[model samples]
Target chain A: MKLWTLTEGNKEFINETGSITKFANRFFIVGMKPRYEFKELLTQCYLIGYKSLPLVALTGFIMGLVLTMQLRPSLIVYGVESQLPEMVGISIVREVGPVITALIFAGKIGSSIGAELGSMKVTEQIDAMEVSGINPFKFLVATRIISTTLMLPILTVLADAIALFGSYIGVNINSVTSFSLFFTQVFQGLDLNDLLPAVIKTFFFGFAVGVVGCYKGFNSNKGTKGVGIAANSAVVLSSVLIFIIDLLAVQIADLMGLNY
Target chain B: MGNYAENNMRLGIFVLVGLIVLIFAFYMVGKNKSIFGGNFELKARFSNSNGLMKGSNVLYSGIQAGTVKSLKLINDTTIEATLLIDNEVKSFIRKNAIVTIGTEGLMGNKVIQITPFKGNSPLVKEGDLLESKKVASIDEMLQTLSRTNDNIAGISDGLRQTVVEINKSTLWKLLGDKAAANGIESTINQMHQASINANAFSKDLEMILSETKSGKGTAGLLLTDTAFATQLRMALVGIKSAGDHANELTLQLNQMASDLKKDLDNSNGFLNFLVKDSLMIKKLNATMDNIEKGTDGFNQNMEALKHNFLFRGYFKKLEKEKEKRKTIDQSLRIDK
Candidate 1:
């Protein structure tokens, strides 16, 4: 009620961490059993991945356009404006495309999952599903987690392509460049190291976002007021986790000598 | 059901497009790396590799023909480079082809450049070692440039020392220091002073010449006065006549001496008899003695007569005449 006292915040933090661990264990165990609700998983995949495309694409496009515009004056100082495609391509493929798309996914999907499940929990729908013996964790949580894990990589790849197209347009606003030459420069500057490591890390980002959302919503309390808190905390936690995961991915890539 | 079908279709389309993009990207990267192309491995041995890396582009005639496959140190001084050349361009790379390491741009990556041999050489077989030309590395070029700069600096130092020596000596001499014994300035200054003196002497000569033209001095009169010149000419003529007359008188005197000698030899003249005849010379001597005595006696008589009154008047008149004659003779000698 008073937000938190020191002792209460510490106690709540410990409880949340324990709940996340138990939820993660249940999510993996349920994810492994092959009694997947195909129709529900498909519907969730469509909702999580496809419904999020336009927002992801728009944000991806603007992100690339703004990045290129901001980078232009600095690169012009170095007289390397001709290398804009290569530089922008490498940056998007290795870092920007995946991270930004994942953050957007976290905001849109993470908040949605938390609020939807939180309201259902407040309405006693999760209890009803459990009483009916329908395995709500698998049907609700596992499908969403699996859908997010699968969809984010696909989304990232699409977002990266769209962002490069946006960067191309950004390049053309000031200078003329043939599309073939632009793409060639972009592809020439990228290696498997840039593409594979970035794509691989989005799986973890999707998992973290989904787990945080489900953990918040599945443990909702304090009635309708807790529903809003769950959604807010899901977005906040998933965003912070995205940066942390990105940092760890870079370190791992660096350790494996995959980064140049 | 219809909405679900539509969503599934959209998902399928999205996944398909994403896959195509990924496949295309991978294919482009693989093609550039020569992974998808049919390539043959060829090795070249070089003394220096010039920082050429494993994935560096291989070029033939300024076009991309292949990529470097691997590099190994063959020995301490040589590097063995394996190149994967595209099979399509392999036929053009003859057995005599030359490989050299070069750079992409001024600050770009290193590349391997192959020069295909001209006409009718056998094609290079797979794994055949091509001829390699060692290019100068940036470090080597910088070292040679630094050595050349050092040589130029040394030469400039020598020239500066020579210039400094010249300046020290010449400047000292200009300030009138005699210690700069070999200074050119001193000789130049002496020549300058001599020129100034010559200019003054010429001016003096010009003044003398102008005065002579105006008939001002002795030389001016000699040069300009005709009357004075004529008088000088007459005096010179008179001197010449006097010299001729004196020469004539000497001839006459010599003739007289010869005539007297002839008379002495003939013993016909009284002067000859007086000189040659002993008995006549004796009588002549006696007569001269008597005459001398008589003259002495006459001088005594004159002295005695000077004391007498009547003779004193006569002697005074004679003395007066003698004095007058003596004065006249002295005047004549002075005139001569």
Candidate 2:
């Protein structure tokens, strides 16, 4: 689809919208057969999990550091400087943890998924799979969906942890705080309302990444140039989807009376 | 393969450690939320809840003893809030304790505060109702402030009118005028003059008194000599006798006037002749008729005189004669 794909008439809307649902349904069908897709899932896990660790850590650490530095002075004005760790920790866990991790996932996992699939398309591997009677869609789409579904919440948890550590280090730059006290503050500031909604939204984020990456890669054309287009478009689309999904999640959570 | 395996092992350990730390932090936070711990329930009700909700802090002496577990509307006018508190802190809360709603920071969440009641013997029973203090709402404070502002406005209006009256009143202007100042100054000068005159009069009276003490004037002779006193007393008695005679003559004149008034009322008074004497009346009437004819003749002559210079000169001569006649009467009185 072009950038203005949604601006077209109902026929185009149906074609574009219909394909997403169609792919999601097929991915689910393939995902049910766990034994067949184990190796694929393992490989995806390694690529998404271990490979993405350093980037997520770096982003998470910086997120914690910057947030603490920005929030410290304001808390100090309120004579609440002691609660800085708790405040920063709550913010990171509830909001920054999921969003930053998902954005980074979109940038890293999304582009890689698009490039890999786009290259396979350009090389005629999809055609070869079709000729050999293997379901190429199932093989490619299921592994990504499973891996992303399992990975994003885990990544968010990891991100929230790393961000708090960074905040602790940041706090110690100007003031001393015990690790126990720091964690206490972090936990004390958080409740179910802060934690559950953030964790829940990451599933949508993972789904967006999986579906958009697979769609862009699976639909590649124009030989060598199409691979680059697919990779770039996948990152952009998934990033947009992450923000949109976050907005809807917040609205729904607000309606449900979840205070964050 | 050996080096690669070692690197993978270290990475796995690192990921495992990171996961453990993350879980530990989550558990700590969850425990603070009363998720992992066995907690007892406490409830505080306030008349003005002020936007307090579930999970708002329940504070005892500025320490967070628990969290608000839930809020339920009891009726149209009241809300029941259930709290989940750590079992350790529940003993300190008594049955007679009062709960009031207060704010955390200026812009922070509303918290339920329990104040210990020292006087009451009955302890707070579990699920028992505690008396709630009606924490004044911001609206109530604003209403009082508006009344104060209106009173201030009214006072300022009254003060402004008073000032305007002072500016415009004629009496106020009169007291302030430069001419009035001069009037006061002149009055003060006259008073000074009067005071000086009184002092001089007093000094003169004192001098006269001194002279009398020395027996130097007629007053002194009268005061100093006993014979002079007797003679003066005799002279005063003779003067009183003469005054009595004069008074008797005045009484006689009064009696005559009384008689005349009675006669007039009876038409037999000499004054009644003026009113009833026929010959006198005829003469007076003839004189009045003659005077009328003469006045008419005089008026005709005066009108002619206005046109005739000779007649005007004759009237001027007559006016000179009248003046001469009055002069003659004056001379005659002097000659007599």
Candidate 3:
């Protein structure tokens, strides 16, 4: 009876692999898809970018404000009070900006993708599409994956900019600095060494968020509990992957002597 | 449809703007390294480059002129560095300029400074080599300071030893020891002796002067009588002159003696008998013995005469003269 159950599990694994391959093959099928599906990309961008803006902005602002408040005393100990803006600007642009923005994106967009897709799977919408010979993976998973993949980096860049502005506001709360000079000091402290590695790492962060969210939601099982598992695991896995990818990127960049 | 297209356009614009800003920032930082601007190259060679790396700031007259573009080991000994100078200030660097590695500040980055010479030669070309001066290292300075301190310590030690030696020397002991006590004792003894000797000598001198004042002994009379002293002085002056004249005559006498000896040795002149006189020698000895007996008889009579009453009376007269001197001294005494 255990041998019979093992055979059933193996058969299910082989069937899943076979369908995943079919989905990949259907991705390039040109004639079946509508040109108006491009509208869906825009809608995804709006939903991802515009809908998530408030939370991203709020997180960015709080991150900037709190980081400045925390780091200010340490920098002051070094007698570099005038360099606070420049230091904060460099940290925000190079490290904090990308990382905090990516984590926020992971929290907002990752769960959104997971829940939306997981709910669809549970409601038999995915099965209906499959029964009609429509590839649900290509339609739903690909769109959400592609949307997160593209949207996250853009959102991160916007979030980084807003965060720096929020840091400027936080700086002015206790310190006085002009807008142009603050940015100049910020940009002066920034080098290609700091900027390139940080920006490059954000792409991997976005990709991880998309892939992990899509993978979890698509492979989700059970009933309503499966959707909960999908959403929870998507966020947890994406956050973990974000840190993992960042660590690896830092190591590789350090090995290349691109970042110090 | 329009809304969707417009949203896409906005996204595209956002992406473009982000890329542009990132690129611009990179360009600004790169331009600080003179990567974006036009620059000229100047080469300089140094015997010891002192580990000056590429991208070290090059300064001229305390102002930033360029950066060290490359450093290469020329041989077993020397290093050659290429400086990327700002094109606008190329004319300011003359051929005779000296380049040396210096630091930005005590805790700052390494930099190369160009020390300009007095009169300008031709401007340094792209590959021209410049002279290098050695920068004193902190370790070397510390070593020199330690050596100086060591030298000072040695001198102080030598001085201390010299002072110790001086303190231990006989001269210092003589100055500082029981010499004062010895001196005091000896001075007291000498003072007592001198007082006794002085009293005795004064009594003797007083007796002699009294005797001489009444015309007694020869030396006493010569010392006490004023006329005798004057006559003795005149006689001495005359005798000195006579002695000088006699010495001059003796020189002539010596010449005469030498002439007589020459004549006697020849035995052919008037002195021939003197050279041959064997019988005359016996006659001369008898005459000399007779003269000696007469002198001995005269000496005996003189001694007897000195012990006679008149001689004793003369001594008694000298004692009376002393008595008279004592009376005169008493009469002349104002305190009495």
Candidate 2 docking DockQ? 0.21
Give candidate 1 regions above 4 Å deviation: A1-15, B48-50, B171-336
| Docking quality level of the chain pair in candidate 2 | incorrect
- The TM-score leader among the candidates is 1
Fraction of native Cα-Cα interface contacts (under 8 Å, chains A and B) also present in model 1: 0.61
lDDT by residue for model 3 over B66-93, one digit each (tens)?
7788988999887889988877667888
lDDT for each residue of candidate 3 in A1-260, tens digit (9 for 90 to 100): 99999999999868855754564455436314664355566677667766676788788888888877787888789777677777887788777878888888888888888887888888888899999977676667666666776666666666777777888887888889898877776765666677778878887788778767776677777988999898998898789888998899889989998764
Alpha-carbon deviation at A37 in model 1, angstroms: 1.1
> Candidate 1 residues B121-226, lDDT tens each?
8998999999998777889899999999999999999999998898779575566765555466688898899999999999999999999999988899999999
Worst-scoring 10-residue span by lDDT in model 2 chain B: B6-15
Candidate 1 global TM-score: 0.70
- Local accuracy by lDDT, each model: 0.90, 0.82, 0.77
- Per-candidate DockQ values are 0.54, 0.21, 0.27
Tens digits of per-residue lDDT for model 2, A1-260: 76465556667757866887787887777656654656566667667766787899899999999999999999889888877876887789778889999999999999999999999999999999989987777678778877776677777788888888999999999988888888777777787778888888998899889888988898888998999999999999889989999999989999998864
Candidate 3 collision pairs: none
Of models 2 and 3, which has the larger TM-score? 2
lDDT of 2 at B109: 74
- The lDDT-based order of candidates, best leading, equals 1, 2, 3
